[model samples]
Target: MSSPATTPTAARTPRKAALASWIGSALEYYDFAVYGTAAALVLNHLFFPTETSPGAAILFAMGTVGVAYVVRPLGALVMGPLADRFGRKFVLMLTLFMIGGATFAVGCLPTYDQVGMLAPALLVLCRVVQGLSAAGEQASAISMSLEHADEDRRAYTTSWTLQGTQFGTLLATAVFIPFTLLPEEALFSWGWRVPFWLSAVVVVVAYLIRRHLEEPPAFQEARHEVPAGQPVSPLSVLLRHHRAAVARIAAAAMINTVNVVFTVWSLSFATSVVGLDRATMLWVSVLANAVALFVIPAVALLADRVGRKPVFLAGVLGPAVMMYPYLAAVHAGNWPLIFLFGAIMSGCLYSMANSIWPSFYAEMLPLPVRVTGLALGTQIGFAVSGGFAPVLASAVAGPAGDNWLGVAVFVTIACLISGGAALTATETAQKSLDEIDALHSSRTEAAELQALGTGQEPAAGRGAEEPAASGAGR
Candidate 1:
């Protein structure tokens, strides 16, 4: 029997761990959503000069939003190995500080008046850092939460990390409402800066909570039992063994495009093309997200009972269907229809993927390579779809205006692709950590057998029969 000293105190604090993950994720996404809000409402007017047409200026500001997504996959590539090898907690804290500091610096940047061409350039630099910070935040938090959770309860626990994201959106949007009420001069001059500046304070508190966290027992055990031969890097193992799994994950992650469409492009569309009031559009976001606060957790509980795929597919299908009515309402400038369709599309429907993707995406890979695989696949996919999607949606809106039908079709097809890819994945809801982790277990067992032949007690212990290939069906 193991001694009390060997008992994993980290796994014992699942609730605390989940709470910490929730708060940190909330703060991280709050910073992101704040940037998005700024890009939509004020960025064109503030950072970039108005000598450019408003249309061209908005396009450039929106493109800056995509810049972060562009860097996210690179961030994942750089940070995933560190999290996999070092421990999730340290990396989580590092990402938090980087994101918070970068966001705070954004508030401090000069406008084109003071800095000329250099102003937008500086803003892009800060956004790139924020994007890199974001790349690892969700993946690391989910990995730690998953490792600390009970086998049956993993989905429910991991769902909280995503729940935090909804709260962040709510908070970010709420902060902007009062600011939007300001006169155009005041709103652009300083009102938008408050939310970004507040990120620093939240980061300090979240960092304190996260710094105390210990690595989960599963990760600690794997780290404890290094193989007898030369150690392999997680990157090499991921490429050689889990190539197909990563591709599938990236494919399924196309769902992020749907999210970007709802949050970013749709807002820009309603305001610019549809001529909806800025406050009206902002309230739609706040209310829909408020409803989603409850919706996301409930959907996740159901996922724990049913399966990740069904819940996520329902999420994908609902929004794909609703994407039509919601945009139609925006085109009509009908407030009630806009709120009704918008709430369901964003709050109830889109949230299905929001609640479940943390657990669903993480479960696709075995533990040893889980962080890198999840980060690489999801961030890269998000980069291609979510990152540049707003620019695409804007172009699709076309020179004729409010041609949202094209953009709506773009979003629907993306959802169909992600949902179809999800169908090909295993139903991991009922599986244990060890069962979900097949490839690593097989290799460990093979190493243990080799150790036993040398008359050394098996250092890593035995595992299930090895898969014929790393990407073979679980």
Candidate 2:
């Protein structure tokens, strides 16, 4: 029996939690996407100035974009536990400020002409801060929204966290378009700074909205159950109880390679190699992501109804096949085909996976370590795959930059790995977090008993106990 205060019906504020998650993720990703657009369009020239080869500069700038991702795993180790221990709102507010401050600092940095080698050094530092902040942002937002949601609508509610990301990408690219078209000198000197600087305004707005968000009832209940002065360590629980779940999530997150390739690498490949107009390349992302803003929720709604695995596997595999055609359209220099394929690949196919991953991944863990597991697992996978995807895609495309086939093959392989991982997961969308935890316990006990070749049934409460209990809600 649950107390009225801890009851799901009484305590969950699904709409408010979803709204906070949506806005915070939007702002966080806007800061992130702004950096990606700049990396593709301008940062190479400004920060990583090269004397002769433009290819080296492009690679170097893309490398800095990956730098944030490289640091993200470390950030997850820190922020994940903090969020699980303290509260989701604390991590949300803290990360919002960290990302906003770092992004604003990027806009004010001196370029290579003014500061020589020190210019890129500063840019990398700011990106490090952004990475650390981003490591926890989505995971906490998802946990907050998921915990506040009704059992039947968890996937749909958590989908808004990612829905916000689509809006952010759309907004970032749209905002960067005019700046991309500016006169070369002015574009390099001042125009690029505006977008990064503008993150400040959104940060304040997000903070105001997020400040009033109540901690979800599930989290509050779990905290109350802990003995005073004896805090539970999420990392310990995670490593002891959830290693397989973490590994599965890390592999599944490789699906983000599709997103990275679509958003970052393709932009660079089209403009730098294929010699397409920069604004045209940028708009392809803008328009595709604009459609994705709508497609994401629809896909999430479908996930809730159909099951996470089918929708997830479709998202994973659809991009694998779509990669070839999308890149071919870019190579052919056909604008209509580019827009058409880009919209289908990014806007429709990729949205299916992206919108539901927060819930899909989070549902695999119990309530106590949900945020930590989600953060560490996804960050590790994102760093390994999505983080380095641009540079890897650029490298495989060959030095001549005409090898579109190799890039497509690379994306296909990554997507397949993700889809295979998705196949191993039990369908979690149809179950409550408690049911998921009990299933994990029973499976673990079954495995242990099987190893011993015993016919005896384990004690009823032995495998499924406190700290890993249903009361802890994942």
Candidate 3:
């Protein structure tokens, strides 16, 4: 039950872990964001050509964007358990290779004109591989960051995971901008593939950073806790002991729909439907995410002080209210309002939630199931809300594809679900992992006692008696 080699008190490397997570996450999301941008701007024509009706082409292209999400939950079921059982660093390295390889392959695929139905089929297969790799990326990264962090600064440290994502989105959009401005013949011929091909560079950089990283001390210690040859089943533990935690996390993560709608749907709506300049519309994303690079860390620091729920719920509701006007500005072809609302809604407001969820959700579970629970729950939610958001928004926008009100309403409803779910969560800012684990254990014991009609005290009731953080909300 105890091993000298895998001590729980091993040196913590918060800064190193955070840096590794940031680079790996940036590379993973860069690949993902590249596909989303291509789906919106370029793939509709090259891979999904409905010569008689552009709407069919748009739907097909956006549907491919959702394809990865569809498989992410399935991937999570496999990768999550592997990370929890093997180690965070191992899973992270494996996922990095899978995502990088699949993304680079996207650049080399044949277009619809060259390969007929085979083009779209191959594209979907590559997207499925990407989704599988991404399934465990964020969860494993969050676990690594949280385990390595100082007790007082988990939120700030974990925020780097999402900050990297913002940077990835910015880089992806910025790279795609010149492609949009290319001469139509050249643009369609080869310009768009350049961004996907560039994924190779980031893969090498991220792998170099992640490979040298050590497994978190917490994970290593947990590995030794079990008797040798009696492997831990993280899925069984997750489903049996943490169903409510998983449900709440899944519901709250629906907030990511704001990002999908903003980054992907809005881009296509502005350029393809509303006749906006493609480069200008792309710049809106590039600028908004550029601002998010600063905004995410700032808001995360605030969450560390004020508690995660308040900052995150503010983000959820702010975007819900702002979605209407943001889409309205786009539909009206008003440049100033578009940029203003876009930056405020996504760059500032959405970053608050994005910045906090990694720390907040990870704190809801114990060490053994942390990665598994986070990956499965968040991936399922993402598949439904984020993966399908662009396709759903496009479908709801009426026959003319300009029903901005319907899209706004859809996003608002997703926010309501997210906010409502977040309201039910315990505020976990500034809590140490041990304390949070104790709290969850206490709750589980209490629930089990109730089910058994025993009415006994929980063994770990100390965590339940203490207030989470000064002024932390329910």
Using lDDT as the measure, the top candidate is 2
For model 3, state the Cα shift of residue 456 in Å: 27
Candidate 3 achieves a global lDDT of 0.83
Error of 1 at 368 (Å): 1.1
lDDT of 1 at 209: 86
lDDT of 1 by residue, 410-461 (tens): 8899899999999988899988776677533355344332222122233343
Q: After superposition, how far is residue 23 of candidate 1 from its true place, in Å?
A: 1.4
At residue 147, candidate 1 shows an lDDT of 79
Q: Rank the candidates by TM-score, best first.
A: 1, 2, 3
Ranking by lDDT: 2, 3, 1
Q: How far is candidate 1 from the true structure (C-alpha RMSD, Å)?
A: 4.6
Look at candidate 2 and give me any clashing residue pairs. 367-473, 367-474
lDDT of 3 at 456: 22
Q: After superposition, how far is residue 11 of candidate 1 from its true place, in Å?
A: 3.2
Against the true structure, what is each candidate's TM-score?
A: 0.86, 0.86, 0.85
Task: Give the TM-score comparing model 3 with the true structure, all chains together.
Answer: 0.85
